[model samples]
Target: MAVTASGVFRRTAIERADQRVSWERTDQAFFSSGACHVLAWTCRDFYPDQGIALAALYLGDFEHPLHVYARWGRWVFDASGWNLESELLQANSDFEGLPVREVETIRTDLREFCEKHVHRQPHQYWADPTERARAYVARYNPPWL
Candidate 1:
């Protein structure tokens, strides 16, 4: 199948996440393994006026969210573009038998969230996530988008 723009974004985001994790001397795929919040924040920042909210896909235990993505209405956006929520959920077998919860707001403090979940401290480069996200979106944005 032809690669979609969403696919490109997803791959590039994962590559970026991998590079971020590599700084800690590991070779794991952080984006797929645990760092989805980065993409969720990127999506939210890029579409600030779209009423986009965050959602979590629970892991084996319903209490722990294993994945986070952005949702606007019935559409979901992560590293990928806007996709139907049900379809997106169905595409990931990891979510097949799990519960999902829509987060009304990010409860944790931003820096704390990054330190705890993202495993990255605030740096001069990415201290302001909104700026970083905006730059990334602008880099990949097409006129048609």
Candidate 2:
């Protein structure tokens, strides 16, 4: 997996595929994980080098938006030319004003980081993003997610 000049995700599977295959692969992942898992995975994949901000984001509850966002902006700063401001920017997207693309990107990067550094083929899609997120909180949080 590699990041493009525009800081866009260039996955190994994505880069090798022809247009149709690429679309199919991405679309498949999207449906299986929902759009949010993509973002969570991004954070999980990238930033494995370790940082408090991202850790908090991964462990932090959804009620607090800043934890995930601060790390995203930090990655944007580290990577350069990233529009980190979009961390929470909501646009009129498919899910009725869903602005999750940026977070998805972050999750993707984080996942890549984990794979490259830790060599863990961690699965992001655990049936549901919300359930998975709750599980994450459960495991990482003090008592329950």
Candidate 3:
């Protein structure tokens, strides 16, 4: 048996947060604000057959994406966890009544996505994603492991 997409999301989120990669500037849990797109793409890639796609939670304007997460049907997966689309909105007060756009065109390259969308000092996180992931899992020792 293999890990589910939600499992991958949870593990990836926690590990990435723990890694505290250079691009991230947050002391909060979950992924950094600017790393959402990369994290969402990672979750989608981990379960390609699951039809997981990326979606952007925008503020009042569609011109910018305030947050990004993976979506499979009506369910959304983020660093926080798996949640219903409505629940995700309600959980984040800023996005409670905002618009969410399903990203139709996903860039195949992480670097490209960062260059185009990430507002901060965007990083590709491609130096050794698997190795970096392992570093976190080793330190945290999640019970499910």
lDDT of 3 at 126: 28
Q: What would the TM-scores of all predictions be?
A: 0.54, 0.26, 0.56
- Which ranges in model 2 have alpha carbons more than 4 Å from their true place? 1-35, 50-70, 74-82, 86-88, 92-145
User: Cα lDDT of model 3 overall?
Assistant: 0.49
Q: Which stretches of candidate 1 lie over 4 Å from their true place?
A: 1-30, 94-109, 112-145
Q: Model 3: per-residue lDDT, tens digit, 1-145?
A: 1112221233244555554443243211334243456566766666667777777665555575656677777776665555676766554533335544434445446566556764332333424343332332233222122
Tens digit per residue, CA lDDT, model 1, 23-123 = 33211133333345665776676777777777766444445455566777776664444566676665553334543443344556446666655444325
- Best-to-worst ranking by lDDT: 3, 1, 2
Ranking by TM-score: 3, 1, 2
The Cα error of candidate 2 at residue 84, in Å, is 2.2
Quantify all predictions' global Cα lDDT against the true fold: 0.49, 0.31, 0.49
User: Cα deviation in Å at residue 53, candidate 2?
Assistant: 4.3
Relative to the true structure, candidate 1 reaches a TM of: 0.54
